[model samples]
Target: MDDSLIIYVVASMVTVMAISCWRRRCQKSLAPVPSGYGKVFKSHLFGKPTIVSTDPEVSKFILQSVSEDFVPFFPGSLTELVGKSSILVINGSLQRRVHGLIGSFFKSPILKAHITADMQRDLQEIMASWRDDQIVYIQEEAKYMVFQIMVKTLIGLGPGEHLQFLRHQYQKFVAGIISIPVKIPGTRFYRSLQAKKRMMKLVKYIIQEKKKNNTGCISRDIIDAFLNDGSGQLTDDLILDNVIDLMIPAEDSVPVLITLAIKYLSDCPLVLQKLKEENTKLKHKSLEGEDLQWMDYMSLSFTQNVISETLRMGNIIPAVMRKAIKDVEVKDHFIPEGWCVLPYFRSVHLDKEIYDDAYKFNPWRWKDKDTAASSFTPFGGGQRLCPGIDLSRLIASIFLHHLVTGFTWVAEEDHMVNFPTVRMQRNMPIKVKRKNIDILLS
Candidate 1:
């Protein structure tokens, strides 16, 4: 045989072997496990080996008892984009201090008042823009409305060129949170990084303006609150990171939940009927006409149930990633230090043992079950639980109140997809019509 031919044959063999090995590894990463394999399982995701837990007990332990042993594990792309000081990835004293500062504000009476006033005004404006029989993209409209509300509530931003510019930059920045980490020009990561830089600059300007305009008194909005913080714990970077962290979820997750709630209501007419009945009664009982009060939202039982069911089914945040800082063992599974552990939240939400007809969209199931039980952790659990839970629920309830009370919509999309995020394939277009004005009042 010729030397050239022999060399070509050897190269071909090597290529085949490499391809075979890669394929096998990919299969192992994605393979389905047997029923008896304990709650914890080892798997590979995106070519990186990690441990995943579907056990609620283990999840609770990791999120609460052993929280110090594991820290949030963000992809290289996300850490670079969100910055190092973001509360989402930080731990220890810094996390607590940041959390205490922000948490106090979020839970304060002033912020709640602001949220109520802002959400009502913004929601009313958004609803007013919808003409009878108009085809509205639920996801797009919800995102715009929620983003506006979040900006106004969090940073005191209002309709203007700056808001528009920031909105555009934010859309780009969040789009790359899950993309490849390559920094080459024109890549998603590159665009996202550029967008992040613009956003940070904008935030810095806002912070400086807030500081310059500070009155000795405390302020209602988050930016003003941080600026007036006397402890000196809040650095510019810390303020920017936490604000961006909060904004990303407010922009992405909450809107998705709102859209999903609309989608579910459209598909499940019985649930919609119950929600409408509940909200309509409240609408008629409102002594202060034309606006909903904080108390009114709190009294919405069936409507809240629908929101809970929507969250459970939507699974907007499907899983949370954590890295083990120390070796841990739960049940029979041993997780070593430096390994990544993922708590598959969707698994628990959809577990057959916990929920009857788990695959079905049944809001009534929540009527008898304990909605706050650990089994349902859509907002997560323990110390790191989303501090915005009350705010998120309030937003959902307010939107549902307006929607069910004033308008009726029909779903234009037949399906929703959940991968990187839960969203309708066609953005969930809906044809909305105004309900009888008299009926809304009655």
Candidate 2:
């Protein structure tokens, strides 16, 4: 009956009640409307009539629909920040043209090799800076490392003044991605727009320089891909818009994926041990001091499974947004013209009926499963599948290889937040110590 004890009990009760209320609210929002559409619901969202589908078949149909039927739809804040001409927003022939030019380059062997070397070298450099029992904020390290690699790939820039400046501006630009759409001074959106102008000014200079020096020559970076296209369809503004757009995924999803994998692995000791063993065996096979090739990394079957599981659970991109260009019916569900249609991938991914022990992180389950199945669309689907999917996977695979083989770490208290974006609450802090290679290999 002490006063302090009474206060503590009351606070606990309040917290429980708050959590219960939040859950109930979420359930109510997700529940189908009075039309009894089950997995499909009609609701007003983002100031428009919307059809939100959690059914995999319906979701797949919408994603695979032709551009004439459904096109990319983003919020006002995102559209303004991403630009009007970005590959993210453009549709039909223009979008296809850009997608073709970039997709081929993104999947080329040269690019893959470059990414592997850069990721390994940069990861090694960062890991080397870690001291024994140091509490490394992996979110920061992952961002630093991934951002540098992405900049190099995009513009062929290395560690120097230019990269640093872009990194600084990029942080401001990203801050406004989900901010209120006000362009006044001191606002997140305004700062983001200003930051973008600065970054684009630098990129424009780089493009001008590239045009002068490279011309028709094949440069390994993305700029080269744009420059060397014989079609003559791309303008400087389009290239600039797409470059800034591409940088969004670099700063957002890839680093988060790496951080999430580390977070999940830290919590699941058995899975971590198995993953480490797989990568360690690969390490043992390559003892000549030669850098591991892209194939070498890709061939790690179990490592790939872990990446698959991470993508499934991570759901870095929780939904695909599109506006119906015309009235359409998906799996007997009617979608009105010009309405926002969202295929909620997160709901499907976490469905208990689809994945056994759905909420659990189990990489082994992927061993017998087909990642190409409709149930697994982490990178979206159809022609709009993320072009950087391979690159993202390869980067993560290499990072995990080096991380598990070269060091040991204990993750600090942290949790993953899914809404807005999937990110670690505490920047995924971990105390890591270098592992002796001699002992580890043996």
Q: Between which residue pairs do clashes occur in model 1?
A: none
Best by lDDT: 2
- The sequence of per-residue lDDT tens digits that candidate 2 reaches over residues 1-442 is 4323533565456446534533444345332323242676655555566677778998999889989999999878889998888999999998888988878888998889988988887888888888999999988888888899999999899999889999999999998887667788877788999999999999999999998898587767889889998788889999999998899878989999999999989989999999988888888866657668998898889888888898999999988889988878666567778888889898888999999999999999999999998888999998798899888888889988989998899998988886457899899999998998789756
Of the candidates shown, which would achieve the greatest TM-score relative to the real structure?
2
lDDT of 2: 0.85
Name the runs in model 1 displaced over 4 angstroms.
Answer: 1-36, 287-291
True lDDT of residue 233, candidate 1 = 73
The global C-alpha lDDT for each of the candidates, from Candidate 1 onward, is: 0.79, 0.85
Error of 1 at 317 (Å): 0.4
Q: After superposition, how far is residue 246 of candidate 1 from its true place, in Å?
A: 1.5
**Candidate 1: tens digits of C-alpha lDDT, residues 1-442:** 4323533564456446534644454334322333234556665554445766778888877777445688888877788888888888778877877777777877776677678888877888888989999998878888888888888877888889989998999999988887767787877888989998998898889888888888948775788877777787778998898787788877788888988999888888988888888887887865346556776797788888888999898899988888888877665556778888788888889999988899899888988988778788898877788888878888888888888888888778458887566888887888999888776665
Worst 10 residues of 1 by lDDT: 26-35
In candidate 2, stretches whose alpha carbon ends up further than 4 angstroms from where it belongs are: 1-37
